[model samples]
Target: MKKRKVSVLGSTGSIGRQTLDVLSAFKEDFEVVGLAAGSNVQLLIEQIKEHKPRFVSVKDTELAQELKSTLSDHSIEIFCNDVGLEFISSSACDIVVNGLVGSMGLKPTISALSHGKRVAFANKETLVVAGGLIKNLLKRNKGEIIPLDSEHVAIHQCISGARESEIKRIILTASGGPFRTWKEQDIQKATKEEALKHPTWVMGPKITIDSATLMNKGLEIIEAMVLFELPVGKIDVFIHPQSIVHSAVEFVDGNIIAQLGATDMRLPVQYSLFYPQRRELPFNLFCDLLSVGKLEFEAPDFNKFPCLKLAYHAAKEGKSYPIVLNAANEIAVDMFLKEEIKFGDIPKIISSTMENHKPSEPSSLDEITELDARIRREVSERAKTSKI
Candidate 1:
C-alpha cells in the first residue's frame, strides 16, 4: 500500500502531539509533509528536526525567526500568516489534521478542503461557527471532513454503514467535569484549579473549562448537527459520569447501539485518520466494571449550567447565534482562566454578549468570520469592564 502524506496543524497542541504518536507507529505508512504550531517554537523545532517536514509555520514572527536561526543549516521552509495557508493549500499532503483552537481553524480548513485534501478535524469551533459553509465546500470539492473529537467520532463510527432513516436519535455522553455535583453557590465560587480538574480526560485548559461548564458537550451537539445533517431536536446530551461509553446512537427499531472503550484520545484520532481499518494500540485494558461500580446518567441541569442551554438555543435558533455564542464563550473562558473573571462569571459574560448580538444569516466563510471577530471584540470589552 502507498503511504499517505499528512500535514498537522497545531502540531504542538495536545491533539497534535498524540497524532504524531499514532503516525509514528506507521512510519512507512505515513509521511509528515508539513507542520504548524502556535508560539511553541521549541517543540516545533524539535518536531521539524525529527519529522523533517518540507514546511513549517508558527503564529509568532519572533518564534519563526528563532526557528530559522536554529535550523539555518537545514533547508526547511518557515512561514507565518498568509504563508501558512499557502503551505497548507499546496502541501504534498493527502490528509490535513486541523487541530487548531477557536475560529482560527476556519481559513486553513477551507484552504485544505478547496484543494481536495481529506481533513481530520479537531477544531469543533469551525463547524460550530460555519458548518453549512464548510459542508458546501466539501460538496463542491468532493472532500471529506472527519471528526477527531471522541464523542463525534463515536457517533460517526457507530452510524457507519447505517442509513440516516434507521437512526432515531444521536446521544452525546458527557463527563460532567469537576463541577458535576457542586452546589450552585459552590460552583459560583469555584477556583481555576477546580474548574480545570476534569474527571475523565486531560485536555487544553480552555476545553477543560468548557467541560466544567458543560459547554463542551453543548458545542458537540452543534457539531453533530452539521456532521450528521440532523435536526438539533433529534440530538441529545446525557451526563454519563463513567464516560466509559463514549457516545451512543438509537435506531427507529428501538435498538440502542453504543461505542465503549477506555478513555483514550488516540483511539478516536486513529479512527479518524484510518477509517474502515482498525489498528492495534497499546492501552490499558477495559475499565473494570466492578471498580467503576454502576455507570450513572442524568439530565443536565441547564439552570445551573447555562452554557449548555445557550449552546442548544443557538444551535436550534440556526442563524449566526451559535457563532456569537462560541466566540464570546472562548473569550470569556480565556478571561476566567487568566483571573480576569470569576469562574461562574464565564456564562454570565456569554449571555450578556449574546443579548447584544443581532443574528445574521452568513452565507460564506468571510461573513461568518466577520461575525466571530465582532463578537470576540465586544465580549472582550464587556468582560474587561464587568465587575465580576
Candidate 2:
C-alpha cells in the first residue's frame, strides 16, 4: 500500500485539526508533507513537532520566520502568504486538502488542480465564487475534486449507484442554528455567543454565524449545484433539527436515498480522502431508533433568513455577483464579531453592498480579485451608515 502524502492548508482551524485526527488514526496510511495556518504559531509549533512535516507556512512573514527559528531542530522549509500556498500546491503530495476558509481557498484550489493532484475540498466559498472556472479547470487538467462537506458527501454517496438521469431533486438538510425558532423581534438581540451555539456541528466562527443566518445552507446550495451539475431549482433545502441524516436525494423512481451517521466531520473527510475505498475506524453505532422520535422538516422562511435569499440571488445572477455577496458577507461578519455592528445589521450590510455594486463578468482570476476588492471597500463604506 503506497502511503498518501498530504498537504493541509488552514492547519490550525476546526477542519484542519479534524484532518490531523484522521491522519493520526491512520498514521501508516497517510503522511503530512506540508501544513499551513493563519496566526496560531503556538499550536502550529505543537503540530509541527508531532507530525514533523517537511514544510510549514503562516500568514505573517515575521511570525513565519520566528516559528522557523523555534523549529530549527526539524529540517523543515517555511513560507508565508501566497508563496506558501503555492508551495503546498507544487509539493510532492498525492492529495491537497483545502480547509482554508473564505475566498482564500480559491487560488490554492486552482493551484492544486493545475498540478494534477486530487483535492479534498471543505472550502465551499471556492465553488460559490468561481464554480464555472474551477469546473472548467478540473476538466482541462483531468483531475478530480472531491467533497469533504457532510451534506455534499451524503448526496454524493446517495447518488453514487444511481443514474444521474433518474435524479429528481437533491435535498440538503440544515440544523437551523441556535436561532431557528427565535422570533424576528428576538433575533436582533442574538449575541455572538447565542449565534455560535450551533445545535449539531462544530465549525469556525464565520461558518457558525453563516449557520445562524441559514446562509451556510444557501452557500451549500450553490456548492451542490456546482458539484452535481444540477440546476439550482432542482436543489432544495430542508430544516432538519435532528441533523442525524446528513442529506438525501429523491429519484424519479420514487426512491429517496439518505446517508445517516453520527454528526461527525471526520466521516466525510475520511470518505473524500480515501474514495472508492473505505477504511476501518471505530464507527458510531445507531441506538434506539424508535426512541429517537421522528425526523422533522420545514421550509426555510426566507423572510426570517434574508441572507439565504441573497445567496440564491447571487448564485443565479452569475458573474461577479457571488463574489460581491461573499466578500460583503465576510466583512459584515467580521464587523459583527467586533461589535462594530449589530446582529441584524449583518444582512443589511451585505444587502446594501450588493445593491450598490455593478456586476461585471470577470473573465479571469485577476478580474475576480479586482471585483472582490471593489466590493469589500464598498461594503465597508455601506456598513458605516447601516440603519439596522
Candidate 3:
C-alpha cells in the first residue's frame, strides 16, 4: 500500500496539531511532505523533528532563519510568508490540510487546487470570502475539497449517496458558546475572558470569540451555502449545547439523516484525511449516546446575537457582502479580544462596515484580496475613531 503524501498549513494551530495527531496514529498509511506554521517556531521545530517533512514554511524570514539555525538536518527546504505558503500548497503532496485562520488561507487553497491537490479544508473564511471563485476552480480542476469542519463534515457524511434533488435543507448545530443562556442585557457587557470560554470544543481565540457571539455558526451558514450549493433560505442553525449531533440533512420525504460523534475534532480530521475510505484509528475515539442521555436543540435567537443575522444577510446578498462581513467581523473580533471594543460592538462594527460599502463582485483572487485588506483597514480605523 502506498502512503498518501500530505501537507499541513497552519501546523501549530489547534486544527493543525490535531491533524498531525491523526497522521501520527496512521503513520504507515500517510507521509508528511510539507508543513506551514506561524511564529510558534518551537512547536514547529518539534513537529519537523518528529514528522521529518521535506519542506516547511514560517510567517517570515526571521522565523525562517531561527528555524533553520536550530535544525540539525540542513537538507530540509525552508520558505517564508505568503509565497512560502503557496509553495508548500503546490508542492509534491496528494492532500493539503488547510487550517490557516483568516483570508490568508484563500490563495493557498487556490494554489493547491491549481496544482491539482486535494484540500482538507478547516478554513471557513476561504469559502466565506471567495466561495464563487473556489467553486469555479473546482469545476475546472481535478482538485477536491473534503471539509474538516464538524458541521460541514457531518453534512457531507449525511448527504453521501443522496441525490441533490432529494435534499430539503441543512441543519447546522451550534454549541451556543458561553453566552447561550445569558440575558441579553448581561450579554452586551461580556468580557474577553467570558467570551473565550466556549462551552464545547476548544478552539483558537478568534473562533472561540466568534462562537461566543454566534458568529462562528454564522460563518458556517455562508460556508454551507457555498459547499452544499444550497440557498440561504434552505439552511438553518440550531443551538445544540450538547454538540453530539454535528449536523443533519432533511430529505424531501420528511426523513432526516444526521452524523453524531463526540466533540472531538480528530474525528472530522480523520474523516477528511482518509476520505472515500474509512480507516480504523487504532485507538478508541467513539461516541456513546447511551451515556449522553439526551440531546437538546433550539432555534438560534437572531435578535440577541445579531452577528448571525448579519451572516445570513451576507449570504443572501451574495456578492462582496460576505467578504465585507467576514473582514469586518475579523477586525471586530480582534478588537474585542484586545479589550478595545465591547462584546456587542462586534455586530455593530460589522453592520457599520457593511452599510458603508458599495457592493461589487470580485471576479479574481487579487480583487478579493484588495477588497478584504481595504475593509480591514476601514473597520480598524472606524473602530479606533469610535465611528462604529
Candidate 4:
C-alpha cells in the first residue's frame, strides 16, 4: 500500500508541532508532501531539514527568501503570501492537516476540499467563518473533513456508526482554563501571563488565551454545530477541570456514551488522520483509577465568561454574525495579549463589534474574506477609542 501523503499548514504552532510529532512516530505510514508556516523561519528551517517536504510556504517574501537561502542545496518549491498557502493546499496530497490560526485558514481548507483531498481540520475558525461554504465545497468535490480538536474528535467518536437521530444532546467538556476558580473581581485585572497559563493542555498563545476566556469552548460549540449538522440548542458545554473526558453524547433513550482520554492532542490528530482504525502508541495511557479518583463537572459562569455567551448568540443568529464574532475575538485577543485591553474587555470588544455591524449573506469565499478584513479593521479602530 502507498503511504498517505500529508501537508501541514502552520507547521510551527502547537498543533502543527504535535502533528509533526505524530507523523514522526508513524513516518512509515505517512509522507510529508508540503508544509506552511508564518514568520517562524528559524523553526521552519529545522522542520524543513527533518521533513524535507517538496513544497513549503512562509508569511512573506523576506522569510521565503531566507528559507530558500538556508536550503540552497535542495530544489524545493517555496511560496509567500496567501497564494503560497493556496498552492500548498491545492497539492495532490492524500490529506491536509490545517492547523493554522484564525481566518487565514479558511482558504487553504477550501482549496484542499475543492480539490477533493481529505482534510483533518484543527482550524475551527474556518468553519466558524464559512461553514456553509465548506459544506458546499464538500458536496462539489466529494471530500470529507476529520475533526482535530480533542472535544470535537471525542464527540465524533461517540457519534460514529450511530444514527444521528439517536443523539439527544452532546456535552462539550472544558478545562475552565487557568482561572476556573479565580475570584470574579480578579478576572478583570488578569494579566497576559495569567491567561496564557492553560490548566491542562499546552497550546499556542492565541488559543491559550481563547481557552482562558472560554471563547475556545464557545468556538468549539459553533464548530460542532457545523460539523455534526446538529442544531445549536442540542449542544451544551460543561466545565470539566481534569480534561479527562473530552466530550459526551446523550441518547434519546437516556443512555450516555463518552470518549475518555488524556489531554495529549496527538491522540485526536492521529485518530482523525486514520479514522475507523486505531493505531498503537506508547504515550498517554488510560487514566489510572487510583490516581484519578473523582471527576467533576460544573456549569460555565456566563456572567464571568461572556465571550461564550456571545459565541452562542453568534451561532444562533446565523448569517454573518458568527463571522464577525470570530474576527472580532481574534483581534480582541491580540489586543488583550498586548495589554491594549482589560481581560474582561474581550467579550465587550466582540459584542460591540457584532452590535455595530450588519450581517450579510456571504455566499463566496471572497465575500467572507472581505467581511473579515472589514470586521478586523473596525475592531482595531474601536479598540483605539475603547475606554477600557
Candidate 5:
C-alpha cells in the first residue's frame, strides 16, 4: 500500500497531538509530510524530530528562529506565520488535517482544497463562520472534505450511502458537558476547574468551556449545516449524557441510524484520515455497551444554556452574525479562563456582541478575518463593563 501523505496544522493542540498519536500507530499506512504549530516551538521541535516532516510551520518569526536554533541534523524546511501555514497546506500531500483552532483554520482549508488535496476538518470555526464560502469553494474546487469531529463523523457514517433528500433531520448528541446536572444558579458561579471536568471526551480548554456552556454543541450545529448542507431547522441537538451515541440521522421513512462509540477522539481522527476503510485498532479501544449499561437522551434546555440559543439564532440570521458569534464566544471563553468573567457571562458577552454587530457578508478572507478581529475587540471592550 502506498503511504498516504499527511500535513497536520496546529501540531501542538489537543487534536493535533491525538492525530500524531494515531499516525504513529499506523506508520506503515501514512507519512507525515508537513507539520505546523502555534507558538509552541519546543513541542514543534519534538514533533519535527519524531515525524521528520519535510516542512514545518512555526507561529511567528521569533518562534521560527527558536525552532531553527533547536534543529539538530534534520534536513527539514521551516516556514513561519500564516503564509507558512498556507504553504504547508498547499504542499504535496494526500490529506491536510486542519486541526487548527479559531478563524485561522479557514485559510488553510481553502489553501489545501485549492491545491486539490482532501481536508480532514476538525475546526468548527471554519464552517461556523464561513459555511457559505466553503460551499462555494467546494463547487469549484477539486478536493473533498471529511469531518474530524465525532458528531459529524457519526452522521457521516450513518448517511454514507443515503441520499440527501431522504433525510428528515440530523440529531447531534451532546455529553451535556460538566454542568449537565448543576443547578442554573450554581452554574453562574462555576469555576474554570469545575467547567473543565468534562463528564466525557477530553478536549482543549476553549472547547471544554464551550461544552460546559453547551456552546460547543451549538457551534457544531452551524458546522453541520456547512458539512451536510442541511438547513438549521433540519438539525437537532439532544443531550445524551452517556457520550456513547456520537450522533444520529433520521430519515423521512422514520428510520433513525446512529453511530455509537466510546468517548475516544482517536476513533473520529482515524476515520477522517482513512475514510470508507476501517483500520484495525485494539479491541479495548472499542465501546463496551454492556458496561455502559444505559444511555439517556433529553432535549437541550435553551433557558439553561443561552449560548446555544444564540448559536441557533446566529445560524438562522446568517450574514456575519455567525462570525460575531464565534469571535465573541472565543473572547468570552478566554475571559472566563482568565477569571475575568463568571461562567454565566460567556453567553451574556456573546449576546451583547451579536446585538451590537451590523450583519454584512464578508467579501473576502481579509474581510472575514477583519470582522472577527473587530468583533473580538468590541467584545473585549464590552466584557470589561459586562455585569457577569
Candidate 6:
C-alpha cells in the first residue's frame, strides 16, 4: 500500500508531538512531508531529523536560520513566520494535521483546504472563529476536516453512518478540569499552578487553563456547532469526571450511540489520521471496562463556569460574537498563564469584550483575522487595567 503523505502544523505542540508518535507507530502507513512550529525550534529540529519531512517552518527568521545551521540535510526547504505556515499548509501533502493552538491556526487551515488537502483538525479555534468561512471553503474545495478532538471524534464515529434527520442531540463530555469540586470562592482565587493540574489529560498551558475555567469545553461547544452543523439547542455538555465516554449522539428514536475509550489522546489522533479506514495498532491502547468502575455524568454548572454559558450565548448569536469570544478567551487565558490575571478574570474579559462588540458576519478570512487581532488588542488592554 502507498503511504499517505502528511504535514504536521504546530509540530512541537502537545497535539503535534502526539501526531508524530502516531506516525512513528505506523510508519509504513504514512509519510511525513512537512512540519511547522512556533518557538520550539529544538524539538522541531529533532522531529525533522526523525521524520525527515522535506519542508519545515519555524516562528521567525532567526529561528529558521538556527534550524538551518543545525540540520545536516541541505536539501530540506525551510520557511518562517505566518508565510511559512501558509506555505507548509499548501504544500504537496494528502493530509495536514493542524495541531496549532489558537486563532493562528485559521489561515493555515484555509490554505490547506484551498489546496484540497484533508485536515486532521486539532485546532478548535479555527472553527470557533470562522466556521461559516470554513464550511464555505469545504463546499468550494475538495478538502475535508476530520476532527482530532476526543469529544468531536467520538461524535464523528457515532454519527458515521447515521442520517442527519435520525440524530436528536449531540452529547459532549468534559473531564471538568482540576477545579471541578472547588467552591466558587476558592476557584476565583485559583493559582496558575492549581489551574494547570488537569485531572485526566495533560495538555498545553493555554488549554489546561481553559479546561480549569471550563472555557475549553465551552469552545468545543461552538466547535461542535460548526463541525456537526447543529444548532446550539441540539448540543449538550455533561461533566463526566472519568472521561471514559468521550461523547455520544442520542437518536430521534431515543437510542444513544456513544464512543468509549481510554484517556489517551492517540486514540483520537490515530482515528482522525486514518479516518474511514480503521487500522489495528500493534500496541495496546484499548480501554478495559472491567478495571474501571462506574462511569458518572452530571450537568455543567453555568453559574460556576460562566465561560461555558458565554460560549453557548455566542453560538446562539452566531455572527462575529464567536470570533470575539475566542479572541478574548485566548488573550485572557494567556494572561492567566503569565500570572497577569486571576483565573476568574478569564470569563470576565470575554464577557466584557463581547458586550462591547457589535455582531456582524465576517465576509472573508481577512475580515475575520482583522477582527480577531483587534479584539485581542482591546481585551489585553482592558485586562491590564482591570476594566473588565
Local distance difference test values of all predictions, in order: 0.86, 0.87, 0.93, 0.90, 0.90, 0.91
The residue pairs in collision within model 2 are: none
- lDDT (Cα, 0-100) at 112 in candidate 3: 97
Q: What is the lDDT of residue 123 in candidate 1?
A: 91
TM, every model = 0.96, 0.96, 0.99, 0.97, 0.97, 0.98
Compared with the true structure, the alpha-carbon lDDT of candidate 2 equals 0.87
Point out where model 5 deviates above 4 Å: 385-388
lDDT of 3 by residue, 1-388 (tens): 8999999999999999999999999999999999999999999999999999999999999999999999999999999999999999999999999999988999999999999999999999999999999999989965999999999999999988676788888899998999989999899999888898888889999999989999999999999988888888889899999999999999999999999998999999999998889987665878889999999999999988999999999999988999999999999998898899999888999998989999998979889999999999999888878999
Model 6, stretches more than 4 Å misplaced? none
TM-score of 3: 0.99
What RMSD, rounded to one decimal, does every model reach? 1.6, 1.6, 0.9, 1.3, 1.4, 1.0
lDDT of 1: 0.86
RMSD of 2: 1.6
- Model 3 has an lDDT value of 0.93
300-330 per-residue lDDT for model 2 (tens digits): 8898899989988987887788888889888
Kindly list the per-residue Cα lDDT of model 4 for residues 315-347, writing each as its tens digit: 999999999999999999999888988898888
**Model 1, which residues run further than 4 Å from truth?**
282-293
Clashes of 3: 0
**Candidate 5, run of 10 with poorest lDDT:** 379-388
lDDT of 6 by residue, 26-109 (tens): 999999999999999888888998999999999999999999999999999999999999999999899999999999999899
Candidate 6 at residue 127, lDDT? 96
What digit string (tens of lDDT, one per residue) describes model 1 on residues 1-388?
8999999999999899989988887787789989998888889888887888988888867877888888854777788865785576458899999888888888888888878888998999889998899879876865788889999898987887677788899899998889888888899889999998899899988889999999999899999989888898889999999998889999999989888877878888888889768777655545576777788888899988999999998998988988988998899899888988888888888887778777789878778878888888888776666632
Preferred candidate (lDDT higher): 2 or 5: 5
